[model samples]
Structure formats: structure tokens, C-alpha cells
Target: MSLRNNPKKSMKLPLTTRTNQVVRRKLQQSSGPFPRQSTNKPQRRPTRIRTTNPMQLLSNPAPNDRAEEQRKLRMAQNRLSSRNKRLKRRQLSRVAKIQHTSR
Candidate 1:
């Protein structure tokens, strides 16, 4: 009952006749290596957007607003340094206490 031994009938066409038909059709529709018509267009360069000056905006800030911003910045720096100094003092005291207790 294998497929190779099965005896189903079929219609057969000659291979050379079929191949010639395909080749003739391909030759009729063949195109050149280079395109027949140019489809590409030249690209335009991009333009830069204009911007306003930052100093002008800062200069026009509401009265006292600029002064308040400067004060806040200075206070932030002071707090950072104070915290660092406090940490160093605590470390030194802890080392000193450890040395005294060990002796």
C-alpha cells in the first residue's frame, strides 16, 4: 500500500515545450540594468530654528524673585557644608571615645 506502488493515472506534458514557453515570456518582459526613468529627487537642506536670549528672560524676572532664588541657592550650600562638618565631628568624637575606653 505504499505511494510509489499506487497506480493512479495522470496527464503528462513534455518538459522542453513547457520550458521554451517560460523563457520566451521572460525575454519579452526583461528590463535594463539601469532604470528606464529617474525616480529620485534632490534633498533640501534643513533650516535652523531661531531662539531668544536667556539673559533677557532672567533680567525681566519679577522684583525680589531673583534675590529670593539667590538666597535659596546660598542657603542650600550652607546646609550641605554644615552637615558634612557635623558628620566629621561625630566621627572624631567616636574614635576618641573608643581609644579612651580601650585604655
Candidate 2:
């Protein structure tokens, strides 16, 4: 007997992205007025990602153009970090003042 005829005995496949694509293709083929497939290629998730230290950024730069872009991003990151530190300091000082005033 064909696997499709026996739903309970059908092969159990993992719900992977490729499996999803196959299922969708089958569904579109069976239905009338099938929805248009997206023109954009599906973005596959990266299998492996690399980790690098943020502080090592300036020391280990990219190619000239990319290096410049990295510099700009680093500077922006530094400014934001400093701004956050200042805000935290102010918050702590306010709490300290409230405690001192109440004592």
C-alpha cells in the first residue's frame, strides 16, 4: 500500500526548512488559484557563527572601506556606553540622596 493512503503509517519527517518548502510546493500544486510564490529568495539561516571580542575591534581591523565603517560603529558604540554609564551614575546618586535625606 502507498504511504499516502495510510496517513497513520506515513513516514515521520522532521519539520525542517527544506521539508516546509516541499510541503508548500505540494499544497500549491493541489490547490486552484494558488498563491504566488515570493519573488525574493528565502534567506537560509547561517549554520555557523563566529564570536569576537568587542575590545579587539580597533586592533584587528577589516579592509580599508570596511575598516572605516567599523570605526564609525565602534565610536557610536562607545558614545552609547558612556551615555548609559552616565545615566546609571545619576540614578544611583539620586537614590543615595533620597536615602540620606530620609535618615
Measured against the true structure, the TM-scores of the candidates, in listed sequence, are 0.39, 0.40
- Residue-by-residue lDDT tens digits, candidate 1, 21-89: 878877678763224334454578896543366776575654587889889999999999999999999
Query: Candidate 2 — which residues are off by over 4 angstroms?
Result: 1-62
Give the lowest summed-lDDT range of ten residues in model 1.
4-13
- Estimate the Cα RMSD of every predicted model relative to the unseen true structure: 14.3, 16.9
Residue 75's lDDT within candidate 1 is 100
Best by TM-score: 2
Q: Looking at candidate 2, what is the lDDT of residue 18?
A: 52
Please identify model 1 stretches exceeding 4 Å from their true place. Answer: 1-63
**Steric collisions counted per model:** 0, 0
Angstrom error of the Cα, residue 13, model 2: value is: 64
